[model samples]
Target: MRIIIVDDEMLARGVMREYLAAHADVEIVAECANGFEAVKAITELEPDLVFLDMQMPKLDGFEVAELAGGKTRFIFATAFDQYALKAFEVHALDYLLKPFSQQRLDQALAHARASLAAGSGQRDAEAAAVSAAARDVAATRVRPAERVLIRDGARVHVIPAEKIEYVEAQDDYVQIHSDGKAYLKNQRMAELEEQLDADKFIRIHRSYLVNIECVARIEQAGKDSHQAVLHDGTRLAISRSGYQRIRAVMQ
Candidate 1:
């Protein structure tokens, strides 16, 4: 099986290389020192399996998984035990804690082999389930997202949460308005709403999530309906419930 080992530390990579050498069928395609390099390599190489390190400089393993998740299977290796549950929630094939024995590594590799043999139909089903689970986990995570990662083809857009002025729902996708530019991200409006900070962004309509800081004022569009007037002079329709929610926050 072809593989890529990702870790920020050279020593960790060396150890993994040494352990995998016992398996003659295993070929280490590339070793990445950071998550960014890992993403790029995963996108380009399309290795059968990736041994990803969770705590790395810049992007973490979760972010790397978000960007290149569907490309190949992953076995996350991390020093922290706290991330073990989260790793499986994102559908990592296996979690290997650091300082693991060669036997442990072999076990993870065996698991990956079994998963890969489960047939394309099963893999696709698991991939879809993984995506849903990932979104659910992101939504329920305590810390509000500081940034949003959107994968577009081979490119990843790292948009800071504070920079997002508003989010407009378009069917299955959400158009994120930030820094006078808009990005289309394949995510549900309700899920994105939960993922963002509740205190900052508000649902001004069923189809709109607006940053409260960007609102100039709320204007009555009809007798009972209202519209949010943004500082940029953009007006968005607000539903009755949304109006009440925004009013409570604004007051």
Candidate 2:
């Protein structure tokens, strides 16, 4: 399996590279010094697995996983115990504490191999059965809407995603409208779309994205254009191209 190691410490990255190099099945594709570099490398390289450090400057392991969106299996390598709970929240493959032994690394690799095998498919019947099982498990593990980290000036605020009525695009940043107030975040609407759950949120317009639960009614404004009135009395104009996507969920 192709792998990438992400850690702020050079020694940690070197150690992981050395260990992975010895394994015939695993190939060290790249090594990142920080979370930003890791994100860029993962987007370009598309490795099968990533050995990520939990704590880092700018972004942490959980944030990286959120941005990754299941593109690669994440194995968190951390020195702290506080991140153990958060690691599982993102469906990490495994957690490796710092100063880990060769035996522990072998055990983690074995588990990863088993997981990969279980997810593998070739035959039609076998593939269908595995796919069905995976879907069922994923549906069962879905979490309720809760707090979302939003950038408020220099600090980040954890606000409820359900409380958000709609989002408006403002140049490079998106303004999150919620609770009769708007919070400006340094994130693009397109990037935010990937992070949000599709079932709960819908892109109604090029400049607007609304929470489905907040949508009160849809008004036909023109031949192909439509307007969605949110529960908070916010109006969002929908284009002809976006109508089909919103209609499927409305049904």
Candidate 3:
């Protein structure tokens, strides 16, 4: 099994590396110090499994898993057991809480081995499970997200929630417009909307979600039709239902 160990802590990496050395069939492909490096390595190496730390600079393990997709299996390692349920919900092979014993690491690896051998039918199911879990995780977040993380290849763009002027849905993706720049993120519009502050962003149309603070005014488009005029002068149509939703928030 080819593996990558990702953690911001040097000692943690060393301990994991040492523990894995006892397994002759396993090969450690890379060690990443942060989530960004982990994403880059995971994309490049396509390892059989990853030992990912939850807390890291740049991106958290959950963000890395979301951005990396469901190709490689993961066994998240974190100090917080609060994430264990979420990790399993996303179909992660397993997770090891911090300061785990060598025996605990072996158990996680055994889980990964079984999962990988379960054939593509099971893999497809796991992928679907992760997709659904991602939406649940977003909607149930303790607080509305303060920022949005977008992965562009190996690069990550962190856009503060307040800077997001609007989001436009394009099929399976949502185009996030912020600071005069547009970023395409592979997420459903409704899912993305759920992650943002509900009080600040309103779905003005099936295709568009706008920041209330960015709206200049609501203008009449035609008889029984209305549109949102943004501070930047861009206009977005508001559906009858959308108009009702926005109107309540606007008032």
lDDT against the true structure, each candidate: 0.90, 0.76, 0.90
Query: Which candidate leads the pack in TM-score?
Result: 3
Name the runs in model 1 displaced over 4 angstroms: 124-140
lDDT (Cα) of model 1? 0.90
Model 2 agreement with the true structure over 1-251: per-residue lDDT tens digits: 98889999999988888777668999888899877677777877888888999889867787776666554778899999866755654556789998998788888888777766766442334445544654454455445435556543334555677777888889888998888888887768876665567788788788988888888888888876789987777778998767777888888
lDDT of 1 by residue, 1-251 (tens): 99999999999999999999999999999999988888899999999999999989989998998788565788999899998867755579999998899999999999998888898988888878877877666655899889999878777889999999999999999999998889998878998888899999999898999999999999999988899999999899999999999999999
Off by over 4 Å in 3: 128-139
Candidate 2 clashing pairs, residues 3+ apart or interchain: none
lDDT of 2 at 236: 85
Write the residue-wise lDDT of candidate 3 on 1-251 in tens digits. 99999999999999999999989999999999988898899999999999999999988998888778767788998898988878855568887999999999989888888888898998988878876886677557778889998889878898999999999999999999999999999988988888899999999899999999999999999999999999999999999999999899888
Q: Would you list the rank order by TM-score, best first?
A: 3, 1, 2
